[model samples]
Target: MIISILVLEGPYNHEASDSAYNFIQAALAKGHAIRGIFFYDDGVYNVTRLMDPPQDDRHISRRWSELGATGIDMVVCIAAAKRRGITNEVLAPNIRISGLGQLASMIHESDRIVTFGD
Candidate 1:
């Protein structure tokens, strides 16, 4: 299966980001192909390089970056990102800032679209 993910919530404050990450990992373990991950709304925060957490805590942004390094398209919505003061300079590795057109393309190319949010 070719699946794309849409995340609408931020990290730490909510469980949506963690849930999405776990879902992707499980899907990959099951041999499902992940077409992409589109971060919209507060979800854009998940790819910020400025994120810092306690040493013992999981680093959410780093996790996303590592996942993205596996060749999955990890995109942050440009409009949403700008609204939240996120720019290319602050984006984590393997992640890019793009427009809604990218999300449209992901939706069009994906066989399934799984969304995690309120």
Candidate 2:
């Protein structure tokens, strides 16, 4: 099935982001296609390229990038990202800065839309 994912929380501070990541990975492993991942609210932090967590911790941004490398679009809500100080200049490779319209389009095009976080 073709799927789209929405993430609404920042990494580490909550489990939502990690859960979303795990779910996406599992879906991909099962040979499902991901239409994209939309980062909304605090989830925009997942696309920030400058993130540097302790070595012991999973690098959340990198994890997203790896998924992006496989051709899944990683979209960050421009308004939400700007409110949190994430600019296009610092976006990770394969991450795109876009408006909510992109999210809407993804939802319209995907076979299923799954959201993680409150």
Candidate 3:
């Protein structure tokens, strides 16, 4: 299956991001293809390269960047990101800032769209 993910929440403060990551990992392990991951609202923070957590804590941004490095399309909504003060200079590697049209295209091309958030 070709799956696209929509995340609306941020990391650490909520479980939505973790859940979404686990789901994607599981899907990939099962030989499923991820068409894209669109980060909206607070979810846009997940791809910030400036994120620095405690040494004992999992680096959420790094995790997303590594996943993105696997060739899966990772996008942060440009409008949402800008509203939250996120810019291209702060984006993690392999992640891109794009408009909502990318999300629409993901939905159109994907066989399934799984959303994680309120």
Give the local distance difference test score of model 2: 0.92
Alpha-carbon runs more than 4 Å astray in model 3: none
**For model 2, how does the per-residue alpha-carbon lDDT over 21-83 read when each residue is reduced to its tens digit?**
999989989999999999999999887889899999899999999889988899999999989
lDDT for model 1 comes to 0.97
> RMSD in Å for candidate 2, one decimal?
0.9
Q: List per-prediction Cα lDDT, in the order shown.
A: 0.97, 0.92, 0.96
Residues 29-112 of candidate 3: C-alpha lDDT, one tens digit per residue: 999999999999999989899999999999999999999999999999999999999999999999999999999999999999
Among the numbered candidates, top lDDT falls to 1
How well is each residue in 1-107 modelled by candidate 1, as lDDT tens digits?
Answer: 99999999999999999999999999999999999999999999999999889999999999999999999999999999999999999999999999999989999
TM-score of every prediction relative to native: 0.98, 0.96, 0.98
TM-score of candidate 2 versus the correct structure, residues matched by position: 0.96
Candidate 1 versus truth, CA RMSD in Å, comes to 0.5
Residue 20 lDDT in candidate 1: 99
Worst 10 residues of 2 by lDDT: 44-53
Best by TM-score: 1
